[model samples]
Target: MLNSWGEDIDINTTINTLNGVSKSSSSTSINTSTSTNSASTAKNGDTRSSKSSTKSLANSAKLVTKPVSSTSSFFGKFTGGGGGSSNSSNNSHNSSTGTNQASGSGSGSLTTTTTNSSEDTREGNDNLTIQKINASIGSIKGEDIKWDFWKLLRFSNPDKELLKFIRARKWDPNRSSIALTRTTKWKAYDHNVNQIIMDGEYYVFKNEMTGVMQNLTLRKAVILGHDLNDRPVIVVRPKLHSTAQQTHEELEKYVLLVVEELQLFFKEKTTTATLLFDLTGFSLSNMDYTAVKFIITVFEAHYPECLATMIIHNAPWLFTPIWKVVKAWLDPVVAAKVNFSYSLKDLNKFIPTEQLPKYLGGELDYDLDRYTPPDGTYDIHLNDKEKRTILLDQWRVLIAEFIKITKEWILSENQSENKKLWLQKYDLSQKLRAKYIEMDPYLRTRSSYDIDGLLVLE
Candidate 1:
């Protein structure tokens, strides 16, 4: 069931591999000298199946199709290039061996240009890379919706993060949570057939605490379908919980939930792909070292052969340090604010301070009173590299603290104690960050280091 290419193809693993296809076909289905008649029995979309006898082509070639039942699994569909007006034209397919070729086992080329397309739709569930996304498009499914085009098409636009997150979010557009799979449960004396639980893993909210207009979305899509060719694929989407009260405390649960869900997907794959997933919501704050280290563990277990790039939608300069901090390369940003952090800082050493950042001129102070609701916290303020600096340092410390706490939580099994709800609350993700602020002494604790201190020590 390999495509035209000889690459080691999968029957279900469509996680992160959709770069391009090899445009080469041999005398595929070159039938006999004469045309024969055959009966059509059944079909399963994009393919026809039945027991038929059309003689000559290869003297005899075998084709078989099982009866398609109401219940079947679909990995996903390819993205379709939108429709456009076309000049009226009539195209005909008349080969010198027309009837002769028609008698072959299969039909003609998989591609055909119509009013909708001027190019061959080389779209199937192939690998999706930067180059392929630029070349052409076809049956794009929810899981196949990617964000490599973030810079030019998306991030460059308004709400770039939101757009990038949506495109990068993965789902088996063909599959719905409304239907549950059949399962068998063990009984005391016998086994009973039961329906599987449909656990829809998702949640959403906006950050009212900031007083700025921002929403967080969380969703996870697990891909486990044999494609037309019977290759396996797995698609994953992390979570984001945005609320006016969203804080780092709530963010940790999303991270924990993501890690837990990913473990389930791994069990379904024989060997996994590059632990593929995306972040469409708050990239920097939502993404952390603990969350990242967990994914790196997945890559080590699953995708040992190749590299995996986890795209971050709308992650400004702040999120890049995640790469620096973890000492791993994975966070690929689509559209994010520029002129800050490690990436910009490295580039800035060559540039001037006045020419520093477009967003950091600090010329006008945004009215915090208007943007945010009645809260002691300022919704908007003048450009303070100091505040961002505080956030960055504390975040690093928080990541360290999270790792220690996470290990303790797991290892604490040997020992026993009564820790409060805050321990359950502060699992280290950002949405949960708010709950941290609402409770505990950590809220009043300011960063001990300053911007200059970070520069010197870092």
Candidate 2:
């Protein structure tokens, strides 16, 4: 099965006698003869294998590539196929073209002619009627929405003559909406979630300036223990006016529901703590769940213990959090060899306010959340090169420490002392370092996941 966004999902694992895939250990490292460990992934979950699957398409387009099953071929009573013409999109949407200038009404009703030559009748169990297809010019510009929607004016709908002008497309707005709403049908980057992966995802957030509506949306849902995007988990948009009807606590409860849906996806062989977040948009406005979300999730999963952190990166006020996280990553690392310390970002938050004044580079716009050094001054003065070295050192050290901790606590305590070979499989210190090294450039440079994690909801 494919997700709403065209992610192919496998759900049979849940229903069959079989269960999740068997998990193997990560590549281990030791001080003995040189040995290399490879990431032998299990089948129960997905790892991002299609690295280039989702190339960014045109700004005015999005791709939908789900393979429609026979049972679901006709969703909501209509379907469309064929490449569209965007240049002419404007011609069909001329708001002024309407016959009535003041009320935005046209003299003729819009209609659609079905291409199926054999089928003349509106056979489906729907309220479809034959109507004239009048081209609507661009009157309302919605993100990823290509077709000009018919405007329903209260004043015009009352007259009998105006009622004759109501003929519209034969397709349901909910289903037919994709023809105009889906922007790109590009090749998706296919990668199964790594059993031990550090991935970040985000959702697009939408809100009304009127403050009457606020909600999150995802094209598809990720099922647990399986690949999320292309699986059985229901992919749904948050209800309209959700913020008005939904409380923050209710949102969190649904978050837990997502976790439960994905419970089967994590097998015992996998031990990495991954993060998943929903990006609601760039503005939190009256909502105040930002800081609480971080404290309640993301950091706690990876800080104390867990594999690499994962995040579903979309939401309102997205820009601020990103600025803060990246800036935090830019703080200084203090060490014995360093006479001068450069800011690596994260540690800068905790530096005393008095000490903050001493640091050469400081970020004033960030929300330090009270860890800011008292008086906001610091004495450390490190160059860019020094800062880079400190960050590398901190990351590498953490890798080593993680392996050691896992060895002491995760290994079977009851195993015989002579049979220690199994412990080697779990010592992934060096391997972890290599993984970070590979991703560091992108993480610091592009922050590429931002696109997938965030949606521009107007």
How many collisions per candidate?
Answer: 53, 96
Local accuracy of candidate 2 as per-residue lDDT tens digits, 1-458: 43222223232321111111111122211110011111222322221221111111100011111111111111111111111222221112111101111123233211223465432232221112101111121221221111111011101111111111111112132122232222111001111122001121111111121211122222223221111222211112221223454455444433433332232232234322333232333243433444245334522221112212333233334346644554353212211111112242432332322222122233323221212111101112212444444554444344334323323322233334212322333344334434444333322221112222221111
Flag regions of model 2 displaced more than 4 Å: 1-245, 273-282, 285-287, 290-307, 311-318, 321-458
Model 2, C-alpha of 271: deviation from truth (Å) = 2.5
Query: 266, model 2: CA deviation in Å?
Result: 1.5
TM-score of 1: 0.20
Model 1: residue 435 alpha-carbon error in angstroms: 46
Q: Give the top-scoring candidate (TM-score).
A: 2
Superposed on all Cα atoms, the candidates' RMSDs to the truth, in angstroms, are 27.0, 25.7
Alpha-carbon deviation at 56 in model 1, angstroms: 51
Task: Assess the local accuracy of residue 81 in candidate 2 as a C-alpha lDDT between 0 and 100.
Answer: 12
lDDT of each: 0.23, 0.24
Worst ten in a row by lDDT for model 1:
180-189
* Residues 1-458 of candidate 1: C-alpha lDDT, one tens digit per residue: 23111123242232222211111113221211111111221121111110111221111111011111111111111111111111112111111112112222233212222242321121121112211322222222222221111111110111111112222322221111001000000110011100000011212112232211122122233332222222223324344423333344334333333333222222211212222233334454355455456445333322222122222333445556564665534333211211222343442333333332233232223221121111323223213435543543443344334323322332222222212212331334332243222221221211111111210100
